[model samples]
Target: MTKLTKRDFIAGATATGAAICMPAIARAQAIVLRWADGQAMNHPSPQSAVKAGLEIKEKTGGRIDIQTFPAGQLGSSRDMVESVASGALTMVTEGAALLGQFVPQISIIEAPYIWRDPAHMTRALKSPLMDELNKVLGEKRGMRVIGVTYYGIRHLTSGSRAINSVEDMKGFKLRVPEVDTFRAMAEAWGAKPTPLNFSELYLALSQGAVDGQENPLPTIQSAKLAEVQKYLVLTGHIITPRLVIVNDAAWSKLTEADRAIVRSAIETASAWQDAEIVSQENSLADTLGKAGMTVLKPDLESFRKPVLATLPAKFESKWGKGLWDRIQGL
Candidate 1:
């Protein structure tokens, strides 16, 4: 047997304590990220986010965790985006038009009539154009695009008017998100755009503050707008693209392997979300009709022609020359 000095006794005690504390320290230091979005908790958009976060944790062997705050829980779309930009929030999934305040040209993704349909918009999202825009966004705004999901086709709903043609929109009070592109679209359609926070839209419609509003069918269903709005006109004016953005600071902290895992998980979630949204959109018209809203399929060409003439020209300067053409070509 070997005799132990006081120094040896203290060293053994210290070693045992560290052995017990190390695992707790590692667990506490796990990379936890917060993701915020405006969609409701039950909506496919946020559900997909939760799914992706789970995948990322599993793939990373518990190194990273993403916590999703949906349904404007963190704040409005603009507020959440601002939080991500300032590194106060880790990530956000929001409309490209809202993000346009940071990278102006990205708004083109949500411009009315820019896409023929959801499938066309999906192709454009996968095109090199998105790469160019993503680079610009990261460089200029310190946000990186990790995934793009197809937000459903936007349509008009009303309480007092049934919008069947462009003339019907003239002087109509239409509620729009506080995005310049949405306002521009409303103007081109001949409606008086009323910029309002989305959370306030239901009340705005119910109180007759705005005569009508536009959003995807899924949003109408999730937000229970059918209870307030009387009509659903399927103008399909815009096939909006939803972007998943990570603050550059948060992204930079991950290793290349972990980054790949994160990106892959997000891409998987986005694909699933796209499919789910399209599926929901397919059936929501009937669902809304059952809920007491009159569904209308108007002369879509009447809506398309005016927007094509005005919007492209209006945004081309800020969106860069020929970018619209390239997107169309895609």
Candidate 2:
């Protein structure tokens, strides 16, 4: 007949616990996971990744603790990948294009126009082919892919002129990701591709080592490239997705419950990241324009032809016809 208030319930519960139980409970549940990335903490991708980690801790009742290191404080992407492989670091969120070096199958996703839309890409990710690719990485390469997050539609920024067509790219010295697919894409577009570390891109642009670079508008804005670059072309050449990866050694050490928790958390986080990128893409050009950069709307069809023409041959050779067909079917 007695009604218990919330405070009464807590007091009653605490009264049943031994004095030593609380500390033991805390000690048994505390888990610390380290996450490293090559972007600033405030950057959307890293921020989203950290938000996911925090959500995991909250949902798990503080049983999981995540320590985030951003802005290359831990190391470069290559170093982070190596650290994750060796179990020196717990996890990292990096561009899938970078994974092409370790798993060539990843290069197929880097091919231009691989997906007609973000929804298409998301669906393709859930396909059995993608599952097989992830399995291979975990079973053979010592890395476990948790989920994929979008970077956004990539565009061209330059110090010289507006890129209106493939012909406009001629003589442009463009900084590209240190990946063969990107290099090949830039070459196909008629630009001279220069491979540079993302960290070195700012200086490369400032010193005129490269006349331009391609990236999402948010990246161009976040890195303050507008201050040095004069033109912005909406090429949407590639829509890059970043992979959430953990070292197989680290992942294998976790209990199945913990692994499931980690996987679920990554999926939730990737969704948040993808939505954030879409929102950013919607507003990025306006923001860049306000920053004094000349924004040009180019004839995307002309650019698409060259990129698509090169894809079939390049992807078929690298990933084979079956996998490429499977992706196309998606």
Candidate 3:
């Protein structure tokens, strides 16, 4: 990753194309795909996406080409999701929690303390329940999930103050991504959920537009949020996930051989990304602590109990009755 050469990703696989990964994607016959994400260029999400793009190129013999846009170059997460939905963009990286907007059942996984650990997330998502949910979204919203990548256990960061209890979060404005599940999760703990785009989070925190925000450590590090935030509370509230998706139109356009190539490459890239994130999370706290942030591992049960209690009444209607129990059984 440190020494990326032109032939590795920029040069198009088997075709004698220019030394640009996205160069001349408008060729008459090649299926050019746009892979967009809101994470920073240095983040593992984009890095893994680049690797997947190269693999797709190689496996498809240059028949499929992918170009990546990082750091909200396309737009906010909601905007990118819509773009992909409308076929304005071929693909985009989005969180499953946000996908709840279209397919509400998937949001059940995003509820607080749902995944016992990162591994549980992998198993639960790859389980039949998720398969059925994916099928629903595919039939209803044209969403074709290519990969499920691990985002680390989420924690809280604030410019001032430490959250030691649910009482401490009372009335505190927490900046959440433009996703409803987070808003409900934050509200369940009695925090004021302030929705903001991730791309604008650092500035929002630095300028006091929001009191605090929650995200995985790799994101906090890659965004240099330590410069703005002071306290890192390891509540480990939610083990989040990001979905790499292509529109159904794009999927239908692909031949069976091309679809297989893309799916295999995506699975390979997702495994690498998930492993890398686990390694990063293992040590990111110390790195953020060294950056002058106070890191505290509060009593997680205090945070977990309140949020978990709300699911049956809050989400059961949409996610279906006993969905949480079924997920846990998985």
Clashes of each: 0, 0, 0
User: 156-259, model 1: which lDDT tens digit per residue?
Assistant: 99997887788899999999999987888788888999998887898999999999999998999999999889999998888888999999988998999999
Candidate 3, residue 116: Cα displacement in angstroms equals: 1.1
* Pairs in clash, predicted candidate 2: none
Local distance difference test scores for all models: 0.86, 0.79, 0.84
TM-scores of all candidate predictions against the true structure: 0.90, 0.87, 0.90
Quote the positional error of residue 274 for candidate 2 in Å.
Answer: 1.6
lDDT of 3: 0.84
| lDDT (Cα, tens digit) per residue for candidate 2, span 202-266 | 88999999999998877887788998998989988887777888888767877898888878887
Q: Write the per-residue lDDT of candidate 3 for residues 212-304, one digit (tens) a residue.
A: 999999999999999999999998888998999889887898998888888898889888998999999999999999999999888788888
The residue pairs found clashing in candidate 1 are none
Give the total clashing residue pairs for model 2: 0
Best candidate (score: lDDT): 1
Measured with C-alpha atoms, the lDDT of residue 142 in candidate 1 is: 94
lDDT of 3 at 27: 42
